[model samples]
Target: MTPYDAPLPQAPAAPALIDGFGRQVTYLRVSVTDRCDLRCVYCMAEHMTFLPKREVLTLEELDRIASAFVTLGVRKLRITGGEPLVRKGVMGLFENLSRHLRSGALDELTLTTNGTRLAEFAADLARLGVRRVNVSLDTLKPDLFRQLTRGGDLAKVIAGIDAAQGAGLSVKINAVALKDDNAAELPDLIAWAHGRGLEATLIEAMPLGEIEYDRTDQFLSLKAVRSHLESFWTLTETDHRTGGPARYVRVEETGGRLGFITPLTHNFCEACNRVRLTCTGTLHSCLGRDDASDLRAVIRAGADDAALKNAIRRAVDAKPKGHDFQIARAAAPAVSRHMSTTGG
Candidate 1:
């Protein structure tokens, strides 16, 4: 076994993780690869050059880093990417995680995908011990789907969602509220997801990275989304909170639950309990800030498990009190890294 495959060090007390802000950091988001099948308007530019295979983290490196966090009390791990499923041998990664990480140490091992490949991997994912899956789908209309995702098949995504449910996996739909795009479809989208027992999450578009569209013009506040949905439905607060920052509600009439992730209208940093490890192995303290620790370099330098764990602790200690996205302008020099590079 390599240094990364070494066993954990001596265990700490019950509370193993504490950030600089005195918050319990228990969730970790890891991006597997910086390659995607579809290029959406808000997520990435059209002509993006994908990362070389040599630059991204290997399965062993991911296991080592993730196991370090787990030993430190990170109970929930979400595998994300430009599109996680597009990466080959993803099921093998899930197998390693299931064998080592999720067999009781982790509370949940989930994934966030663009929903294009769910049909091909859903059954295997459920069999491999995934807790749940969140599929990013902005619109239901075929033409609008193609326009937004730059040539994605709406039927395939819908089929993928159905495939996940058919495999008995809990699914949630993630939709970003773009002002002139799918903002008006919130009620219908939530209703549609509810019809199939999936929660529809309306996310506020954060001004991050270089985009093909005018991000500011497309930015729809959660306040505006609430008002729009209230005109057509009665939404009462629900207690279905999770590790993420999405605030939730239930439809009074249809019993459909809706979620709002408002990085723009209402900041949820106080309850933020997670950290992101980009595909390039940069441990980002905050999504809105580019400050990161190069864990990959440390690991490749032959650090043992103890040293690796120390690096993780040091990175956690660097966690900021909050993000600057709340006051960030669209054109400002904040969060220049695209979502593809960073993960969900």
Candidate 2:
């Protein structure tokens, strides 16, 4: 057949409906497992109960649910976990999801890992069409890293970063700035990532788990962090990209990008356009809030595709305009579960 006689490809379908908050609900964060290798003080304690493997979503179930969400309006998918790479058959799951993108049913697919297991799977993950990765690394110091992660090996995580970079995937380093801990290492972390040609992001410490520290004392706002860096480097705002939380800016002398996720100081709830699915099949509308809908029970009850879709739509509709932690604390505030179980 001649080139002119080729048939036109079909266009991908749009989402079913937009919510009242003006969010298209196009992005989905799927938590594959709640089990993680490290025990960060903010995320979880050294000893904690993990979800039973049986309770977590199966690969088939996750694929089916993700496919349904794509049909509804989820064009982007991010596979997260306590540490997704720790879960088995993750490569197979990525392989299955890749088909949807090829068929124009899914637009973009990404993953968030702790980088402990990324060194082993980086090449395979890239080969499977996962071009984006977010690695959680709080401190560049080996001693501090060990102290923060309880018993994690900082060397392994560094190797993982190198492997990911070698795989030719766009990697973003996620750092949770906690006062009195690794907050002082922010400039060093940014400089290190910039030296290696990778984007570095610093996030404010969020109060979620049953921790003892006061939020006022622990929370290091992005504005303050930026101001601290201004003495060492000048920053200029860069274009905001789609499907992620970070507000980008370029370092003047270094010629590298740095990102800040100021969730606590400046809430981005008004422009929130995402939903989270816990490893146990619960749909969390807001990360800071405990409002969730149990999708596992409904799915197990033989809810059809339409029923599941409507349930997700309802959950999205119920998304709070903004989190009330500040206002709630002024009244009778309550804390939610740890960030590890909540998925960072």
Candidate 3:
């Protein structure tokens, strides 16, 4: 395997979290909360049920789980949300996680945010060992953005992006490509991000939540979008990694690169190196399937760190070789879970 795709060595005395396919799981995506301020039309219902505060994992619990994962060979931790910054005492959580990061236990710590509250936490996050961020923005037009997010302010997101950049954070923008919706504006969004020295990625609309929208109608192909942009700009491959599935490219004449996450067109599960931990403590082995292990149950049962590590090891061993999304819809049902909870 290439160095970029090589299987890393396990820590001394630490169990290697390897799947059936022999892929070593070194990256972990942790959703801090299912609470969000915006109701994205494609993510979930506008008025949805949120977990009770008591149901969510406490800061100490989260820290313990993270430590266990780190001991079991998880090298990178990505903090996700339903807007992770919205959770109470989140900055303290960052400070807590940063301890492991600073002392060399965790190789890297990053975040994927909605950018609504980033303006308030950008500086704190940078100071606390967060070095990179990915902000989700679907459209650059004010009215279109508002309509897409059901009342989010585009100006605020823009200010938040600026704030993230000002804090010396390497920022990237993610735009969900919706057929006949924001499909026409993909290049424009990339241009805007490029002008600001930030790369932008177009992600296909995954069939997840029951949002009163047809996935076939909203799904846009990243391959087609890349071909559309090739008509003008000469694209070249780049080695920069985001620790996810996006294929990054350098666009000539543009100050920044462009990215495409073609999960449908090109599935990367063969080289998949990550698993997700939900805020409520379910460890999802695969995002496109419902294979999960309830970590919260074990913790609440008074399990020690060794037990927690064994639980994570079991989850890794159960990780699916690849998602069956390519199978016919009749044979494989849509991934019913929303991106918010899955930490997509």
Candidate 4:
């Protein structure tokens, strides 16, 4: 067939899916790789073993899976990773998927990165249709940054944020507020992000897996953090709400916005509309719970699109109402896989 004479291909059929809470899951968080440059204390401890390279999904495989999800009513896609930028050919993957984004095949294309390598890839990512970026930067002080990240360069993260903004991508700075460490820097971080036209988000420290200290000590609630910040900035409530976890508010007079994710104090599970796809190809219905359904095995077994969609539907039907960290702690002490592995 001649180039212009070939018939157009038929669009893929949509799949039936349901979330753990029985909600129609329409969002997908895909972890491209389990390898990250920084070893954030909460995500992974020092001296952790990286996933085998062979076990990681290839770019083509990732695109195929994402395409299938998009066909199955996945309107939004977030590229996550141990750090997604660390993966090779990620730009190419975005480029390949961009073609299928017409007709609202994807409503939002976003990414959550540690911001270590974003400086180098921001421009490329912007050109590839990435609309927003959430960078995990907890502290501004170089010493504390190094201490928290365990040998990571804070300058690189700062540069990445700047680069992302320069590339025209909407930026949100994610800060995990600890009790003593960098908790006091909230005002400065807010001022800095506002000055740069970026949103600053303060996230409560979650007890995911094995870490260095007690969960209680590291657990800084949103109320405590907001109490400290309310003294400095005239915090005005915002009606704006995104599908993600953060509760957003605007800073009066500064033209900057702040967000708080209080998973412990104020859980937003009822409005939770997210589902995570792990790097190993398992579909996790909830981040707090360890329950997951294996999609990789089904794909590898030569399952057709109908079979694959059935697997996705079954996975969502198995989604939990919410995580039971409290009960898990009281009971058998359920330890979760690291956040990076879970694509948080």
State every prediction's TM-score relative to the real structure.
Answer: 0.94, 0.92, 0.93, 0.92
Query: Superposing all C-alpha atoms, what RMSD in Å does each candidate have to the true structure?
Result: 4.5, 3.2, 6.2, 3.2
Measured with C-alpha atoms, the lDDT of residue 59 in candidate 3 is 77
Instruction: Judge candidate 1 at residue 34 and give its lDDT.
Output: 85
Sort every candidate by TM-score, greatest first. 1, 3, 2, 4
lDDT of 3 by residue, 1-344 (tens): 78989888875666678888899988998899988888888787777788888878897888788878887788899999888889889888789889888779788888889899999999999999999899999998999888888898999899999999999998989999987679888888888899998878888777765566666767778888889889988899998876688888998868678888887899888889999998989999888888889999999999987888888888899898887564234332357677787775
Candidate 1 residues 267-310, lDDT tens each? 78887799999888899978888889999999999999889888
lDDT of each: 0.86, 0.81, 0.84, 0.81
Evaluate candidate 1 by giving its C-alpha RMSD to the native, one decimal: 4.5
lDDT (C-alpha) at residue 56 in model 1:
91
What is residue 343's positional error in candidate 4, in angstroms?
0.8
Question: How far out, in Å, is residue 157 in model 4?
Answer: 1.3
Model 2 scores a TM of 0.92
Off by over 4 Å in 4: 1-16, 20-22, 327-334
- Whole-model lDDT for model 4 versus the true structure? 0.81
Clashing pairs in 3: none
Candidate 3 segments exceeding 4 Å error? 1-13, 326-333
| Predicted structure 1: lDDT | 0.86
- The best candidate by TM-score is 1
Model 4: per-residue Cα lDDT over 43-88, one tens digit each: 7878878789767777877887887888888888999988998888
Cα distance off (Å), candidate 1, residue 104: 1.1
